[model samples]
Each structure stands twice: as structure tokens, then as C-alpha cells.
Target: MRQKVFNWGRYPQGDVDLLPLYYLEELDELTSKPCIARGNGRCYGDSSLSSQVISTITFDKALIFDKKQGIFKCQSGMQLSDILDIIVPHGWFLPVTPGTKFITVGGAVASDIHGKNHHTEGSFSKHIIEFEIYSGEGLHYTCSAKEHPDLFHATCGGMGLTGIITSVTFQLKKIESVFITRVQEKARNLDEAFELFEKYSNHTYSMAWIDCLKGGNSFGRSIMMAGEHTTLNELNAKQKPEALKLLQGSKLNIPLDLPSFMLSGLSVKSFNELYYHKILGKVKQDKTYFDQFFYPLDAINNWNRMYGKHGFIQYQFVLPLSTSRAGLVEIMEKIRNQGSGSFLAVLKQFGPQDGMLSFPMEGYTLALDFPFRPGLLKFLNKLDELVLKYHGRLYLTKDARMDAEVFKASYPNLGEFINVLDKYVPKRSFSSFQSERLFG
Candidate 1:
């Protein structure tokens, strides 16, 4: 009814009116036109959306779900949390999920999003079977690795540039319960973390949190956490209910953004310290709802507001195994030397690269949140050079910086991806700051 444009980080952006279209004759014809697909609007960056008016929400619904084969066929606009609400009760969970469940299934596939078990499952493409997409030609087509391999490869992490994904069918994972039996292993230093991860990686899931401010023995201080869904026996009668479902009956928005100064190292460090210590120890049988287990941060309404008004950018990248340790040391040293305060820092071990443009690789990947500083662009430029020097690359989904030439040099498959997109070249679509910078 009204135009309301929202950015994931409350970053610089203007309002866009999202027109509504359904699946009937009027809607079908509308959807068949040239347009960009928008999901829960959780790109963190702008690749998955455009400024052009598109009818995305009107077609939202789970088109199909065959529990028999653990296959889910749903509208592209369906949010992951919406799926979890119905899936968990049936002993099903998303095989790979990003940090927040607010993202949509289409967004996950378009970005080829990876998760904690990236070392095991890869990304959304690995689980995705097929998709129905409407292209710039105003026609829907089918694509998959086995069918239209070229389109499928390009569409995965294509940033919605190739076409508008209308529906996707993907494999679902079977789990015993919605609860995760977590183990919180506190590491005094980065070496302890490397040791712990290498030792416990045989477990189901692995992820760690690092204190970007510390160094020496405390340099890269962190806590390594691993977990798996609890079995029926692991859960008591009270813990495993027949119909304990995730609730999403409500949603809230930040009315206005706050000042950039709202987030500082001191405040962020305090939050990180409290978060780290609270979950320390074995935590052998800690229990939680699916939401709490998968997306704990989502509990806070307008959580992005904590970053302040100027809006922050997430610098995430992966360093190959050979240079991971050395590269990480240098990056951390530089950050410390420059007095750059990180609001949030996450470290994850990547197993291997999957999709054509997927970001993870066989090494260590780290994500850090920083407020926009005067020379932030230059700082990232320096970091980019180092990443390339170490045979590393940055994540496109979370990036608000990086040039196209740098991206092409890092990802040799850029040309191939572009060629595939040529089949359905969009003429009048909107891209984010990162998209423009990397592929204008």
C-alpha cells in the first residue's frame, strides 16, 4: 500500500515501492515481465534485489513439501523461518542455514549461502535440486545441475542477475529434535582454537568466536563451539514435545536509525565478553528452541539498530589453508596497530568451495563488523591486496566494498558466470553498492 524501503544495516538507501502481484492471469502476466525477485530483503548487501518496482510478496507461499523424500518445493519468497515453523515439528531442519533465519529460501540459493556444516554440506546449491525462474525475456524456465547445467551454475550465487527465481525445490535434512546439544570450549588463544577445531571437527557442526582486540597468548582469543541435534534419548519427555514449533507471529522494524557513535569497541567488547563467558564450559546438555539454537540474535527486535545510524559494513573473507594462519596474524596485527575497533568478529573453518561463485573455501573464514570510518575504503583496499596475496577472496554477500577488477582477479570464474547470465540479461534492474562496485 505504501512505499517502505529497508536496508539490512540501515545503510544509505532510498525508498522503493514494492508493487503486489499474484499468480492469477493478472499476476501471472505481471510476474512474467522483466523484474528482479525480492525475498525477506536480507541480502546484507544489495545483490538479491533491485530498485525497480517488483511484485514479490504477493506470491508468497509454500507451493509444495514432500516429507516422504525430504524435499521442499516452495515459493521463492518464503522465509527460512517460515519453513522452520512447520519443518521442526516434523523432525526436519535446514541442512545449511546462515547466521539469521530471516533470510528466504530463494535468497539462500541466489547467494548460495553456506552455514556451520559448510565443511560437510557445502552450500544451498548442493541441497537445491531445481528451480523455476522468470528471466528478462518474460518467460519462466527450469534449471539444475543435471538439466540446464550452465544456467544452474551461473544462477547459484548469481545475485539474482540471471533471472527471477519463482520457486525452488531442495532437499531437507532429517533431525531428531529441534534442540542442539552444544559444547562451548573456551580457547585462551588462537592456537588453542586451531587445535580445538582440528580436534573436534569430526563432530556435526563447528564454529568459533574471536576477540579481535586481544593479542599475544590472548591474541585471537576465542571460544570454539560445536553441536548436533539431540536424539530422543538425549531429550527428556519434557524436552521433546510432539508439536513444539517455532513461532513467528510477530515482526518489528527500526523506526529510524541512530548515530554511528552508538556502536564502539568498548560497548561491542563488553557485549562479546558477556556472550563468550555465558556460554563457556562443557554446556554438555544445554537445550534451546530451534530459533534460539540457530538464530539467537534474532530475538532482539531491530537488532541492526545497535550498529547506529551511519550503518556498519561486514568485512568477511577466506584465506586458503596455506596462508590462513599467517594471513590472519597479519590482519589482526594491522587492526590492532590501527586501533580499529571491531564490533563483532566470527571465525569459521571452511571445508571446500562448491558453487561457481560461492565464497567459502578449504581454509579459515572470518567476518568482522566495523562502523564506516573516514578512510574505511582505503583500509579495506589494503586488506583486499593482502587477501589476494594470500590466495584468498572476499564474500560478496556481506561486502559493501571491493572493486570489480579485484573481484575478477580473485574469482577466475567471473567470466563464465557472466556468460551464463548473458542468456537472460536484465536491462532495467537495480543493484547494491557492492554489486555496482564489483560488476557495474
Candidate 2:
């Protein structure tokens, strides 16, 4: 248990692990040497990779809470799930959440993750009031928008390159229950997809699960899901009583990965057809479980292994809505022409981004998961070219392949972001796969 532990990469291919450091004393001791700390190891690529990774999960501890203010503080390794179990029933939730709630609070800050409500709530950092970060100089300090403000911005999405996040404080939203009242629409093609996005721009959360293999007039055909938390009074007493209990239960994890080919294109196509039929139309206000809605893939343990040992790569990019179609079309074309049809593809509209170096922009973003194969780099590079042509950018948290030149171009504001970055630690230390591969 004290040895190195790795993950399936979600891309379902590479086998990489972290040298777990389960205590704060271990983390402090790591500063003398180049090191990066990570939690859950969920980032698809090497962003969390480092010769020395302080697995901060042992740092887990609930430090403070004020119900009236809805402001909560806890150790960096605290999982959002831990907070949700206590707060959701009380009618408050994380102001924002990523696709899966399995991520740690520290990881959320390091990545500046955005969620379905991004258009409205922005990224996780927007609601973060403050956090405790141990710097490269072996010094510990607290930072926020008001104190060491420069480091605050840098650490927001700095990928933990400036310091090891120790503890964090954030504002939680009060919610009625763990249920979402959603509306679904089926689009015949990408054009219809755009129309629906524009039409439902006001929803608290909006996203689309696309069918990537289908092209032509039907390219980007999808099911646009729009929703918000259901109010307590809106539900019957019977449902309310059940909702509270569901939040407290433990969901089982996918214990082992399946045979890689279990998620082949042919099989995925059939699944997509079924999903389109089931979720696309006006379905009743059917009772939904948070696990299913928020973390679809989490249901199946080691689900990525369905892609086989080659491991698939996730290609995700955001394009200003004005150019989403053209950029998307070109990228989709490249994927299909390369005979690399992804098993799962998703599309969503990003609202205005507030983070200085946030990944989500005011536009449309698409993510595709495909089985790994030779020539993938060539295909992804071509897609990156198309993304750049449209003034769009890629998600570094989910990336394992992009180079620094491309990254610098993707975020020209990086200079300003980096200026904010160096202030956190005058010694200029800390590391991540990103620091090694893209920021070196």
C-alpha cells in the first residue's frame, strides 16, 4: 500500500501511477526535491504525474462549518461527495460541480474545473473563498482574492505548479434535495444543436451527449439536457423522504475493468441509438438519482478498460459559439476520416468564463472518447490546428499530449497568468505532467 499506485488514465490505455504520500509531514518533506501532489488520479493524462506525488488523500479532514453562512472549510483531500452527503439534505450544494463528484477539493482548485452550470456559476474557483497552500520554499500560507491575490489567480488553474494545496474553504449552495428537474430535446443535426443551445441559454445547467460517428446533415446530432435542482415543495412528501435517504447511501464502484473491446464502435452505436430514444424526447419528470445524472460512467467500475489495453484518448476543445460548427465539423471530419470513431462524444455551451486562465470560454465545447490506436497523435494535432484556426482552446486537465508552443498559443493570456503564478513562490518550484510536458 505504501508503494506506487497508478490509474487506467480514463483514456483507457496508459498505466501510470503516483508515489503516494499519505500525510502532511510527508508533503512538507517533499518540497526539498521537485514534487507534485495529486488526488484520485482522475486527470486523463500525465497532468498529475511526477516522480514524487504526495497522495494527499490522507490529508482528509473536515475542519469547519457554519450552516447559516453556508461557508465550509476542510482539508485539501476532502471529496466533494463528503460535503454533499451533509449539505444536500440541508438544501445547499457546491455552487459548481464537475461531471463526477469523485474529485478532491484541492484537485478542483488546481484544475479550475467547470461544470454544466458553468454558463451561470463559472468554474470552481469562482466560489472558492480561500485556501491554505504550502509553497516551494517550505513555507505555509493562506491565500484568497484579497490576500496574496496574485497567487490566488495563479493557483486557481495553475495545476498545483506553485504549491501543494493543504486546506480549502468554499461557499456551498443550499439545495432542496439531490434531484434535478431536467428537460430533454433531440436534435437532428449540429445546426439544430446550435438552435437548442441558443434557445435554452438560460438554464442552470445545459449539456449534450453527441453521436460522433454519424455525420453529413446529421453531424453532431445530440440530446440536449437542460436542468436545475428541484425545489423541496415541488416534490411530493414521499419523494422528498426517499431523496434524503438516497444521498446518504454509498454507491458501488466498478471493481474491475472490462475487456477493452466491450465498448467498440458498433456496440457504442447501438447504445447511442437506445440513449437517443430514451432521453431525447419529452420524458416525464421521472425521478432521477444523482449518481446517474451527474456521473453516468461512474456506474461501471473501470469502465474505461472497455476501450481495451491500447487506451483511448479524450479529445476535447472549446470554440466560440460563432465558430463552433465550422470548427466542430472539421474536427469530426478528421476523426471519421482517420477511422477513429469515438465511443462517447459530448457537446455543451460554455457561459462567460470569469477565471483569469479558466478553460471554459463563452462558446461551445465538444469532448470525444475513442479507443487508442496508432496515428492518434497525428489526428489530434490536426484537430488542434482546426481548434486554433477558430481561436478556440483545449482542456489541459484532460490533456496528456499537447506541447507548450501550442499551449501558449491556446492561452495567450498565459503570460499574465504566469505572472500571477510566480508570486505564490518566489523560489519558482512545484511540478505536474503539465509543468514537465507543456510548461517546461
Candidate 3:
């Protein structure tokens, strides 16, 4: 059936022929078409948009799980939330997770998702033992780091163009409790934020909520947060009994689109000021549930509606460690001077990346949300030039309209990724609108 589909960002939506794959046998017929597999649709871009799309939502199921060894094998369509439901009680958690838990396991691998722990654990694919993929040429193969290593690397961040992932087996992280011992510190400016990040370099998770609207001395002011999984001994009297309890689903919902004016510079600046001061003192410590600490946005259903029906673009990019400070200063200055404010600005330090097309490297990454208003893309294009000048690149998962020239210049390993795709999906039967836009 033809239906309109949009990624989490709700932008660049289009009508497509949607095919739901309920059984493994169904993939045989779908492989011949040019399509991309759709997970929970949280990519925030058009990477999963195409004329034909295979919906993997119904293909979710756990194939095997060795609780004792913390090994899990599940169908690609399984969501992180579902896995958390089964593993949290067993003291296991995802090795690496993005901000949201609604994305599918396949989507995680495809984007090679990273998290607050990227400086420690790397990307989601690093812990992957193996995965089964049905190639565009009607070939099925089980790939891993040792076997078909090239295919394994390419598929990890290939944006689903190499093929459709069927099942994945990966290692799970063990946890003593479902709580996180969190510490919040205020960084009056970008320099202080960098200092605090270095001071807490040993922490398992670290990230910051930056106030991108501020200029001059207050520019880049942020609240830095670091956390580690809480142990049973850390739980207080009332929390000891249910230390491993799972999180409940969100009750809050933004039923309709909000007024676009609600996110104006004045409103956003006011909100940022309030949020920055909400931390109280220079430093604060507390124990929070894993869900609250890792996925705060998940607490509100249909939260994307807050950007209005026009949708928003999540502009995320990373600069090489050597150039991060200068690059960020220039980028933030441009944003400030433009008078465009991003209410949700996140900054994090990344250690390294492994996959050929993976987004991260040893650097600092910043993400901002911009309403899809006129001239936003043109403005972002200018930012792209600065990123490239600093030897940085935009994340493909968050990209909606990056040009081919910029895309090619940013990823030095593009040739290798293309070679793997050509070798496996020679007919190019697997493709997406974004793939054509950036790769063709």
C-alpha cells in the first residue's frame, strides 16, 4: 500500500510503497526491489525513505539469549526498549545506546549508533558478534568481524543500502542496578566544559546540554553531566528492594503540533536560561533511573510535534580533536550571530570509531535542533563548509540534505564502502532516497 512515511524528524516525508515483512520467506520476494528496511523510523532523516520500503516492525523476536554469558540473539526488528524489558531484570543492558530506546536493533547497527559512553565503549557494532543479512542480489550471508570483515564493516554504517539485516547477535553489558549515579556540573563557558570533561575522563558516561544562543563571554555555557551505573550498595533504603526494576512507558503525549512561534529565539533563550539554572549549585549529585538518565526525551510521546507540523532538522557534526575548540567557537559564533537558537543542544567527547563509514572519531561532537524554516538549509550548508574546513563531517543518520560533494570529501573511506556494496549488492537493488542523493 502507498502511504506517507517520515523519520523521527518528521521532515522530507513522502509517499512510498510499504511492504511489511512478517516471515523470513517474505524477504525473498522483496529483495528484488529497490528499497530500504524501515525500523522504528527514528533516523531523523531520509536515509530510510524510498519508493519501496520493507517494514521490519513485525519481524521482531528474540531468537536466543544466554543470560549467564550476557549474549543475545534477536531479529533485526526488535527494539531496544523490548530488549531492556527482558534484560534489565537479568542485570543486563545494551553495550551502547543512543538517546532514545525506541529504535530497532537493526537500525542501531545500520547507523553504528554511539552513545554517551562512546569515549569508553565505542559504537553499537563493536559489541556485535555477528549478524545475518539478505543481500540485494538474493544472497544470504552471516557476517562477523572475522568472516567477511569488509562486508561486516560496510554493513554496520551502510545506511541499509548494502542489504536488509535479518538477525543480530551481540554482547550485553552487565549491570548491578537499573539506576545511574549521576553528577551535574555547570560550565560557565566552553573552556570550563572542556576542563570538566577532562577532569571526569574516567567516568563511564559524559555529555552536556549547551546553551547555543548565548554570545560573548556567555557563549557555549553548558551543564555538564557524567554518570555511571549504580551498584546495589549505592541504593538507599527504599530503593534497595527494587534496584533492578524496569522503567514504565511514558504517559505524556504531545497530541498536536505546537505553534511554530513557541520556539522563537526569545522563547528558546528564556528556556535555556531557566534550564541552565535548574541545576542549582555548581555541582549536584543524585541517583536516577536508567530511563531518566539515558532517555529523557522518551518520557514524552509524539514530542516531535513540539517543532510544529513543518518538522525540524537535527544537525549533528564532529570535528577532529585538534581542531574542535576553534571549529566549535566559529560554528557557535555563526549560530549566535544568526540569532537562531537551539533549545536542545548537546555536546559530547568521542574516543574513536571502527566501521569504515561510522560517524564518530577521536573528537568532540555537537548536535542541535533547528526548526525547518526557510533559509535553514542554506545556513546549515555554510556550517558544513566550516566542518569540512576543520576536518569534520556531519552524521549521515541525522542528515536530510547533505550534498554529494561534501559527503564525498568528508568520508575518506567512502571508496572502500562503495567497493563492498558493489561486491555484495552489484545490481544495486537495495537503495534509499538519501543514498541516491548523497552517493549517486
Quote the lDDT for 106 in model 3.
Answer: 95
Best by TM-score: 3
Q: Give Cα distance to truth, residue 182, candidate 1, Å.
A: 0.4
lDDT of 2 by residue, 1-440 (tens): 23444443554232333455556676656667677778877777777766667777777888888888899998998888787777766667888888877788999998899888888878888898999898866578788989987778878887888788999999988777778887788888888888988887898888988888786787778888888777778789788675555543444555555675676667877887787778534433454656667777766656666666566677789998788778888877777666567665889888877555668898988988756667777778878888999999989888878878788898866887777666666555677656777877
**Reference-based TM-score of each model:** 0.91, 0.92, 0.99
Give each model's whole-structure lDDT: 0.74, 0.77, 0.93
lDDT of 1 at 289: 58
lDDT of 2 at 349: 86
**What's the lDDT for residue 236 in model 3?**
81
Candidate 1 ranges with C-alpha deviation above 4 Å:
1-6, 15-17, 24-35, 53-55, 240-259, 279-285, 426-433
lDDT of 3 at 164: 93
Ordered from best to worst lDDT, the candidate numbers read 3, 2, 1
Please give, for residues 1-440, the per-residue lDDT of candidate 3 as tens digits: 89999998998998999898898888879766789999999999999999999989889999998999999999999999999999999999999999999999999999999999999889999999999999955588899999899999999988998899999999999999999999999999999989988988899999999999988898789999999999988878998888888867656999999999999999999999899999889999998899999999999998899999999999999999999999999999998899775786999999978788899999999999999999999999999999999999999999999999999999999999989987988888888999999988
lDDT of 3 at 16: 91
For model 2, the run of ten residues with the poorest summed lDDT? 8-17
Residue 293, candidate 3: how far off, in angstroms? Answer: 0.3
